[model samples]
Target: MRFQNLMFLAGASALALSNVANASDLTAAEAVQEARRAAAERTAATEGQEIVVTATRSAQPLADAPATMSVVTGTELRRRPVQDLAEALENEPGIVINGIGMTRRGISIRGMSNEHLLTLIDGRRINDALANMAHADFDLGWVPSVAIERIEVVRGPLSALYGSEALAGVVNVITRRPSERLEASGLGLLGLRDGKGGDTGQLSALIGGSITPSLGVVAWGEYRHRRRTQSPLSPRESELEAREALSGSIIGWWEPAQGHRIEIGQAAIDDDRARDTVTTGARPVYYEYQDHITRAQTHGSYTGSVGWGELQARAYRSVLERVNERDQNQTPTQPTKATDTVFDGRLTVNVFAGNRLTVGGEHRHETLRDSTVNTAGKADVNHNALFVQDEWALRDGVSLTLGSRFDHHPAYGWQTSPRAYLVVEPIEGLKLRGGVGKAFKAPSLKQLSLGYITVAAGGRFIITGNPDLEPETNTAYELGGTYYGRSWNLGATLFQNDLDGLVQTNCVEFCGVRGRERRAYVNVDEARVRGIEVSGQVTPLPALSLSASYTYVEPRDRSKDRELAERPNHSANVKLAWQVADATEFNVRGRYTGKQTIYQADVPVRLDDYNLWSVDVSHDLTRQLTLKLGVDNLFKKRLAESSALYSFAEPGRVFFAGMGANF
Candidate 1:
């Protein structure tokens, strides 16, 4: 059947070629040139030099970066045939994805909790002002993968640059920029599943072109529709799920004079009537959510040679408003809303002596409002920070980086984070890197203003709050190396983090009346996490590629001799890709997650290990058209992606197919 379909596509292409020959004045040679030019442009857009991510808040080569970082281009993301940021990062080493009904969840890196990491879009922070201090989920439901140009994942401590809440790392998403030429493109998918469901869809669009040499604009949008049934044991029982989102952006660059440039851009996303199952009985309960967000930013930078070095200055402001409403049985009792504003500025100079110096400061203020029957909470937070870093080349192929940041919060007084790194390259294609750093996370407003009544022993109710909670702190060290050659790339790293003053809730049964319990925030004496990660990719044949990654982690509470909750001991992923022909390709992927213990109320619960497999195939029907088919969780693994404390389940086996076109 596949071969027959291929034949039909070939015959249709031939017919289209004949028509073009009969109707166009261009010769075969001219047509071939035009195709080559178009291919060249696509290649430039899809596969160019590795993007220098500002993950450190400083632009640097991903490979040359002293810290561990991974780059996933828009082209690479499409190859995997998955939508959503968490899905895209699942295969990356040292990263774990948690799914909450497909739309809400978090990601853990290097054994750290999801809330430990910070997420940013185009250098602007995405703030979640909830009481728990957790960063909001990536909201993949509204993020259009088609508009993503690339994603950068920087592992390890980054508090020196990003301030509080960056104790784990940073994930920066870069959006697509307009091209100089006029162009249009689209894509779609269709497929079926064995265990749960199937789906079919298409995405078509146009983009690129400059109104004038100084001003450029690009606009693209996607419309996708899929039908699938919820898993039998899912929080929501069997029900059809529908997801639709529309997104578009405009970017303008102005080079008003020499050595200076100004950029302004705005993006808007709207998701309508997203449905999900929330189990209330044998039959699945349904809920609908309407989410919308709009973001706008303007930045200006000036660069020029001054004296014996290059000087650069940059300043920008960004605003984000996220509103979500829930409808359960046509009754909207609770509505949540949040707004964030940030102002940032930085300056740097590169000296002729090969020393790079940087200094910057940022101020962020946030306000959150929530209304629920019996519960109403409002809070505001202000954070101000200043940092400076110096990169010194002590000798040939050897360099050292030293940095420190001072942060002041309205609730927490002065705090300092410091870092040091050394890099030595004794030979080509090999680098030795080591670093030590201190990072911290301030108490979230939810932790400060939390005034909710909870049932204690004997059904007694009690309220709790910790206005004196201190910020959590961590000290970490890492050693790593990277080796790259013509046909293979490999990297390995060993890291350790020591946590102090870890904020956790403790239950004191005797303190409450009627033998009830009172929960309050207290610092954990000590905790530690050590891990090693290895990743590599090898292309032995022109049409075949092999890639693999593995991570081993040991996380423990030093005071109790117990493993941390939801910290996997071992994880691995293997993937194989083959180009069947000029216009066709196939991929197979598998992942394994080892067992881990979940700790609650000082008790431990064990979870079993599990594995999952997936397959994807794509075909290019024409210069401007493509098709993709994929099945995720081929075996419908019923493993838990998160601790049972969250009451969320991983998605079961499902199928997806889509197509795309360009003009």
Candidate 2:
């Protein structure tokens, strides 16, 4: 044994000497390329490399991809946050979740804020818009963790490839495809709040199998019900409303020949929410409210390998419907509905040297059957876009990416977005990257053609939209570097974004409802959004792993001389996991959300900073079944403690138990 060990060491030394000898007369990029090759040899002996597609619309190793990106695999997700995709991404750099209300959440990427962050499923857009001008929220929780194979996140303007709405970045949820062999899985979880009205439960299942030698199918279903949670201010009434949601999807795949594939899929969601007397304390005047949202989508695609390259043609039709009802003093029910339809297609070519060129187009038609109380009448708009991108590998260790897009909205006219990116590996394991890009968001028809004016609190204030609005645009750039060590990884980015023609309602005078100011939609000249993001991970021991990230953002509303609403200047997250045994593990996660500015009783208020911690453990009962137990907000800190930025009640220290299995 001793002799064998000596021989191995001598061989390793000789290889190291050869690399050192070759390091001379080598450019930094060349040296780094050699190091990457060496790393491939070392790790290839243990695990397969990770391949990502969203960064450049092509499959490539994450280490070789020339972009600022992060990936959350199914395994890592099981040990991280459990609530939703937004929470799962909170631990990553350049992402933040801003909550407007208990069930209302929006994703902010690199401080661009709101709908600027575009979301996609299997490369198709998921339309998330409502006539409600006050809320631009997107439900990241709609996707159950069980069905997600992995989530690819790219931080920076991607409008050049994805078109309008990617003014900030992009997140693509990649679902697990049908297996060549039979497979099945299920999950059941029981969760509850600490006090009255805080209870939740969920169940999910999925199955996939080959139907014939050339065909396969996969399907998934999930149902979740959560009760209204009580608020600290009104211990007797619910501050956050309760809701129930049901969602599912099915897909069929046909591989009639080698390197040729076709797919068809359909997905739907039904969600219902209410704020009746049962949860809210109200007088005889029945101030009752109910909301129902339904979404349906069907898509198909054909991908084939052709001479000199591969060709992919895809198309998907998605529809979103929303209904809102209100009643007072047993009055008649007043209902408002909004619906939107989206169509998208794309094609890609492997030009040469593994480089790629892609082109795509999309169209969205939105109609408001009955406008909400905030606006007026039936309205509709048609939006269209065309985009192109080039992922050119200039050399072995250096690469450049160029992209551009043109968007034409019937109401907003034609506009363009363009971007450029460069990457260089100066040494093995170290990558330096930077990019400058432009992105935009066209004004929705509801925003441009609203004929009704909002008189809040029975005429205390008024807000209206203008039809002559233009598209909101952004110019951004980022510089970052990442180092991949044998057992650790670290990265940092410095980014800045300048926004123009921001479309939002602003108070003419004292815009606050109580301030007796009227709000109107107008293009605010410009605003500067800038920030720094840093992230790192380390595996000090085979049994233990640690990951953490921090973001420092400064989102200034240059038009109003104030920081953006509900956005904190500093935020961070940390996660630690330890394997106790072959089938057992424990995890601890903590998050820090810094102070944010808001309005309480129509007065400017600064919320107090807060830290939350959670812990969980998972143990395999058998090779096919696993048990999970965890508690969120273990310290029991909640909104009632400090109403500074309180929009929703925190689920105080709740215990949850669940089980998952595979067959």
Candidate 3:
């Protein structure tokens, strides 16, 4: 579809959804507001901590939560020069930017791969259909920057609450809520590099307010563009792909009567990216590749106060359409589509004194359409799950949580995940927490189909699917503690994850054939990952604050008795922020990444370590206007220029300026 048509359709749908008056109940909104109010009132009482909902699917103080969690507020995001979700989260502890095939990046927590991490928006999973495609980062660009309120990250397996895809952890992006009063905000940014290519620009706007005493609406939009960078040694081939992205969302809420609330939301994303390539062989060839992807989602939920406690139900559908084309030999365009539909319901109530219980069930259906699936060009799968969680207050300042989930899949019979967590407060300012959990990820539809085949490496290799594959599973354990002081806080966690039945491709046909190599998917790997994370924050003066975090991970392939690839052993982040004046703020940040080992064409390659620094300044010119300036990669470090084994480009020494308006 054309950009104009896509935007028009998305805008029209958002407008229509915003005008919806009668939908579900307002229980969720009311609960969020109430939680915020309570958190504000407790800001200075005893322990100063924020309230989080992702830990237990309900509002609770961070200090008392039984899980290892982190929160990045919206205010902190606006202070940095972040163009994407990965950039915004690079500073957090236990996070690494893992490169997928060549250019795509995904989040890796602890020592786990990106495939093990599950991402969600407002507690609903964002379908990851593009995961099967090599070098695709389509899932990270769905949410607009202006619509985000906060992000909650859990650093361990959460399969006890969520079903599949929560094998490693979860990241939930929460959007802003509608207000009773009129509110609006806008931001514009541009960046320029010292070299020939690699520039960036972005624009975003958001507005939200009440249309009636019982109704409210919020809408937002964003546009981003980036130019591809050129390799200094090889100017004919681009190191990065140029991209243009447009995204928007509209959400409406209604309170038909007291103690009842309903919400409806519509969101869309349109992404276009392309690159140029040149190949040298017996005959020189030039090629141009393009990928145009569009995604749309619709979700509705109802929440209300029930006789027992509270009841909530929700349903949503997500659809992704893509058109991919290459200009070598005038190849025809390849069109693929994927859709995910889910229905979920849950009830929360007090089971007895000092105990709270939650019970929920979910049904999910996924469909994929591609030319490689079969002659019919379609494949599908269905899943059903039931889960229950109970929180018991063993005594004052002590809590224990036990939960489990049972999932049934057509291809795979059944899988059960269980978790046990304990939180203890031994002193006035110290808390200790620990947990153990089991998680699993079902094979993708393409992986489970017998007729699936894909050609890669310029058609030199072919991979086929297997129907006798087993689901990959993980067992994890963690222990952590935190200390809160008047002017400082410290936390540390030790975790280990054991994985079995990992799926990989093996030689199935033409094993010795160089040009006609064939492989089929199979489960043939066992691995273990163990890591430790430590972080601390201190305020030496009223205007100055400093924080730092460090992580050390060890990942090994037990089946091969060797260290895994692409995982760094050590990484750290440090930041210093100062309020120079009443209306001005200055910040300095630094990051260190250790050396890594990767295999290249059956040969082991070692990549060198690197360091990066950044400086930022923001000044409030007026009550409603702000100006910002920043510099990234202050020393101009490029991986391609430093390491012979690395094959990616880094646009170093870039300057950026931006402005924002709020009312």
Candidate 4:
């Protein structure tokens, strides 16, 4: 750790303690008690209440939730200039951003792979067909920033309720719902980089209101564009890809009875991206590739009261299409499409005085069409699942939850996932929680189709899919606790995941043949990830607040007996916010990532540690208008200038400005 970083952390801690001690004439414990009382009363007035639903499929306060969870509200979203879901969540505890390509980033939770992370919108699954594709990052930007109400994040496996794909954790983006009163809003933003190229622009708008006594609707649209960035060392070489995207959604709800409601919605995103690069060789080659991608979905949901309990049902169809063309070879364009059709229903009932039981079932049909991989030009799979959960309020401030899910797949037969969680609140403002869960991830359609084959490394290698491959599985354990004071909160958690049956491509034929390598996807890897996360937030003054979090992890490949590649050993984040006046606010944040090890052609190489800092300021110009300005990468960090171990680009200093209006 750097000396300045250590000093910054220590100063923040000291300031928090000193403020509490000097804020009142009473002792430290007494002052905290008084603050708690004040906070409770303030919460009663509708300011400090945080209701989350992703953990148990039911509404509950953050303090009473049965899992390690975090929330990012609409207010926070508006304060930051976040481009997509990955940026919106990169600061949360136990979360990390990983670079995949020149302009693509992935989210990792506690060193887990991105493929195991499940994403949801309004508690419904989004399309994840691109998760296994090369340089694919289409699933992270479905919901526009202007339409999100809140995002609920669970930091551990929830397969017991969500089934496959929830092996690592879940991130649910909840969009704004229809309102009884009419409302409209819009925002415009522009950004410029310090050096050549790398510029950005965005525009978004939304409107919502009641159309009739019992019907309400909401609609929104967004358009964004980013210019390509060029390498500093080589003017003709590109560092970042240029992209243009447009997305929108419309949702409507109607109530025909006192407690019954029906909602229907449609959403779509169109993205066009291009990359340019200069390849150094005996004869220099200049190449460019363009990717056109589209994603669309339509869904309907019903929620109502039944004699025995409450019933909720929903159905949706999602599709993704991608077409790619290269300018150099003048090759024919390649197009691929994936579709998912699903039906799900769940019922919650009061099984006894203190126990609530939930039962649900789901069916999903998936299809993939790719002429290059599937000999028939298409492949399909079906999945069915049943789940049950019981939430028992054992006593005051104590709860226990038990859940299990059973899924049946044609290729894998039947797989079972189960979980048990306990939350104990020995005092009024503290909670201790623990859980043990089992989870699994089924093979992707492309990986499970026996006839699937593709050429790699310029036709030097042949990779084929195996239908006999087994599903990857995991067993996870976690224990955590949180303490909430009048003006501050603190939390810590310890977690471990045991993973088995991991899939990897292995040589199956012509292993020693120089240009005729052949490999098949197989399950023959095991690993484990263990870590600790500590976070805290303190509001020493009504106009100022400080928050910090730190994480340390050890990820090991059991089979190889070595540390996993691209997994950081330590990371941390810190933020300071100040309200200078009634209409003005300022924020400063910093992030630190420790060194990592990566394998290059069988040799382990270590990368250097780095830090990033940013500053943002916002002011309300009027009751209906606001202005925002910020500087990112304040120290001008760049991958090419800092180290040569990595090939991806790290953005340099950027200046951005925006305006928003509500009417």
Candidate 5:
């Protein structure tokens, strides 16, 4: 939360596109009104794309930002041959990436899921999906694809300025910073398909400069290995599940004077997976498993300029741990844990002229420890929040954005969220936006401190926890439209959300006291969702580029009246890129989904509808080096029905190649 300064509050630069390379979160008078609305949009006529600053944390373009974000860059993540971030957002727009088999542990936006979004990297919030009780969300697999430099998602509910799970929005990856003159880079990758044992390997590196002139330093590291799974899965596709990951980060910066600035960072990650020996029963035993995850982070930040305008602050410390080992062939249990810790702070100001304001606060602490139950004891959760925002300017084509936040849980004690946004632009290049928000979701810590007890056969079952659970809200609404001609651009949006008190975990039998049977975690009363989105992009000549998107959702569940388990009510996305000459390049993408419904033991099941395609080609073996080739799914599509819970297997057609270098 720095928002240095730029300017621009009238029509808030109605975001669209222009050309930018880092640095934004405006402040100095909204970066001097976004450098005079990007020099009056470079005298019009399309000015060839590039200016996109995370919807409106300042910088705008991307058709003056209508808040349905998407961005990849880092030069399209270094020439895209995707790897992580759900395969670079599986063709963007309304995201999916859940899994049929190609092994995507999770991803689901617009249609919800993935714990209702909210993942940030340089904007804090970290917890890399804690898997247990079969939640199975590997959180974008092993990130670190050359230390990203872009990947912002944002769609719906910003919890008035980001609070609670953002209700289903916010992705924010944004790595790669620090490089004031001296710089370094590296990338090594290897992948192969068919020919047995798939194969996958990668290594990454980055370093930054400056040693005195005010002190500065930066570093990055990544390591990955895979011995199988480059798409292809069939009842464990030849011993599937052999993976390894290692990650690193280091940052330091200081400025003992001038406008003042400071930063500190540390990051670490280690993930491992292995599985093979499968057989069991009739004495053919074996069955194996291994999983280990560790995460550690430390942070510090501060941007100066007090006396009344620009100022930013941040603080962080995090640790996430997970370990699971399974053999069960004879004996092998014990090892399942989840941990979390966070603290944040933010402040921004302008207070006049178009009015700018922001305030922040957050605290989180969580823990989950399972050794396969022991009457289940010890589970924790503690969270607190406070937020505010404002960005006036009700004249010149209009502009507005209000905010609110107040969380405080202890088994749901306070909630309060609010939001509002509006942008006009009655003519010139069209643009109209709207917003209404509120978000919530809290009640983990094993559903408020769970405790178990089992026995079965007709009694005994006793789960636990639910210190009076509550906290599930959501109340969203959005409307959008954008148009930016000259070359082409179009967008549309209409959203709805209305959830409330949802929690779930049932059971009551004889009401406790000896008769046992009383499970826990309740409050699942209502639900509703609605959606419609459309997007477009075009650039007929000068090297080609076209994009498309469509979405129509209707997730319902108003107290069990229907749909909502696995979402998917229709989705689409298409992409194409070309520049096939000097240095060469080509890209293609396609996605479609529809039909989905779940409920195994209680009936209702229906799943079908699929389509996925991908292709990437690139070259630039000089001026810093780059080469890429790709294919993912490319028509191998999967998911021919499988229930009793789920299993779709979609990840087969595989082929890839990559190379990189820089200095």
Candidate 6:
């Protein structure tokens, strides 16, 4: 790691020297003018009502995609004081952000668990090996909303193009890029939040610029500190936890020639101590946890014309490290640490005859090491896959897509998935589409190794490894239609997914020593989930916009005769935004989540339905400065996005105020 850092620094220095030597070739003023021109062209291309999305592994108009998709642009995200991608996605149709305060959280789409949905950053997966068993939280806290270019959410099965875990869908986060010429930009924010616990402070800053026509770079950092009080419903009673985090990222890009690009980026996050306490008797026992994570990735791509088709190739490598600490004076257990690295590549071609072909492969290897005295162990796993897809234009107004994938895992043998989709554009502004596909997720190391323990019977525990666990599979189908007009747009989708071999742990009373229960992972027979989503945007006035979405889900575990955990049957969101004047705007947003059932430690818990409201106002103070204010959970509703089946809680009402500037 040290050697790599040294080499990167040396390479950057060499490039800087070369740029200085060639300074006479271009002047700063000329570079600025060229950058303005490029920016103008990009702005014009994206100014219409039509939105473009690449969630299908190919760039296509959102209206033409067979599945449901939502596009959230940088402008739309900045309407409020959003901290990360999860916060920005809260209002999107058929998507839910189950945030657990600050450190840990998950995203659920179409009534599926967070692990079922795949998240990608610029087409590269964010490795989270422990997500299935414990708190394997992805560090999205460091990804500032101001640094984002756009975000695309694809609903329904996408395993044919994105690989196994995308049984539910995919969320692709695209970061901003520097212009071809010289330009500088900066943004800063300050905010305070008042909740049940107390008040919290937030600050963030971003600065970026292009050094030359072919070289550009961006750097940003943010810090948030708060002392949060525990809710009344919390089982473990304690004072507010003092939370603080420092996160930052730097990205550098090089475009030496036309149709070629290279990028290197690194991100780091450090969090302060968070303590949870439970009173057993006269003294209170505490569980202290602190997490630190860092990730680095590099990618390069080339595109050009080959024969009658356009061919493109891309390759990338990423490394992630996470260190977790759990300490208690009574229990002298060591901390845990894990590291993961991933490499992937892809090749795609587009023919002039309205046919697109895509082929790709991916390899993932992970290692986990535990240091606790009573639970010291190590495990390694590897996975490889190959996939191909082809889209053919059946006619001037009709298209068909066919694709398949083969995946091999160390624990699970080779598995194949196939998919097919059709699109019919009966008219200029209207289209109908449908698709069917299969997807699967391999078992995690935790599920295969860690033994179950019971604390009810004098802390007696039983440990066992299951080598016979099978992979979970899903067969899904979807049908949707979309209509686009000059100022109005609408989309609707109906989908169903049938699942098999779901991992479940069984515990019977007095099954172990001292009347303790035994637990083991077993494959369940079947489960089914069906849902409908409808969303639209209407512009009644030139300066005002109204958007609304509603989703309904019916998820059940046929084998257990119970509703799936953490899935709400009904949910909806409505938003109204108005440009009151050229320099001022106001917006209001509200969400409703229906009741649901959750299972924890073999017990079922029910959560009541709730409604949340938020409001935001922003004003341009000057040509280079802006001010914004927002209030989340305006009704102060105490609602749980997910059941206590997990050891995390959703936050309450928060107030924010911030400002940004261009220097």
Candidates' C-alpha lDDT: 0.64, 0.71, 0.79, 0.81, 0.66, 0.66
Candidate 2 stretches with Cα past 4 Å from truth are 1-49, 78-83, 130-138, 276-286, 327-340, 372-377, 450-459, 508-518, 599-603
For every model shown, what is its TM-score relative to the native structure? 0.82, 0.86, 0.91, 0.91, 0.31, 0.84
Candidate 1 segments exceeding 4 Å error: 1-49, 99-103, 129-142, 190-192, 195-206, 222-231, 234-244, 271-333, 371-377, 450-464, 508-518, 600-602, 640-648
TM-score for candidate 6? 0.84
Which stretch of 10 consecutive residues in model 2 shows the poorest summed lDDT?
39-48
Question: Best by TM-score, which number?
Answer: 3
Q: Which residue ranges in model 4 land beyond 4 Å of their true spot?
A: 1-48, 278-284, 306-308, 330-333, 458-460, 511-515
For model 5, residues 233-295, the per-residue Cα lDDT tens digits are: 344433346667778888888889877889898888787766654432344554556768777
Say what the RMSD of model 1 is.
Answer: 6.1
How would you encode candidate 6's per-residue C-alpha lDDT over 1-663 as one tens digit per residue?
122343344345434534543453434554455434433433322222335555456667666665667777765666565655567887888877653433356778888877788877777776654443255554455466666778888888788777777888888887777575433443433334454453444455566667877777888776655555664555354333555666777777777776566777776766553545542434556565455555555555555544544445555555555565656654422344445556566666775588888787777776655532125566667778888888888898798888988888877778888889898889986778898999998876656664422222223543344568898899999998877766677778899999999876655344644434565667865889998988877775655777899999999989878898778899998988777765667889988877777765658887777778999987655444456778888877654333434334545677766555444
Distance (Å) between predicted and true CA of 105, model 4?
Answer: 0.9
Clashing pairs in 2: 32-427, 32-428, 448-467
Q: Residue by residue across 294-340, what tens digits does model 4's lDDT show?
A: 99999999999866678999999999999987777745345889889
Model 3 lDDT tens row, 1-663 = 343443454445334433331232234454355434433332322243777788788778878877888777676667655667777788778888877754557788987888888888999988785455556678777765667888888899999888888988998888888575878987666667778666776678899988888899999998877777876666766677777888899999998987788999999989888777764334657777788989899999999975567788999999988898778774534588889999998888987887989999999999989888776789988889999999999998789999999999998878999999999888877888999999999888878888888876555678888999999999999998988787677889999999998888888889856558899889988999998999887766556677889999998989988778888889999988776765667889898888877888767787888988999887665545567789888898888787646545567778877776566
> Which candidate should be chosen as best, given lDDT against the real structure?
4
The clash tally of candidate 2 reads 3
Off by over 4 Å in 3: 1-48, 279-284, 306-308, 330-333
Clash pairs detected, candidate 4: 35-486
| Ten-residue stretch with the least lDDT total in model 5 | 1-10
Give the per-residue lDDT digits (tens) of candidate 2, residues 207-288: 9989888899999987766677755554444566666778999999999898899999999888776664322223234355
> What C-alpha lDDT, on a 0 to 100 scale, does residue 554 get in candidate 4?
96
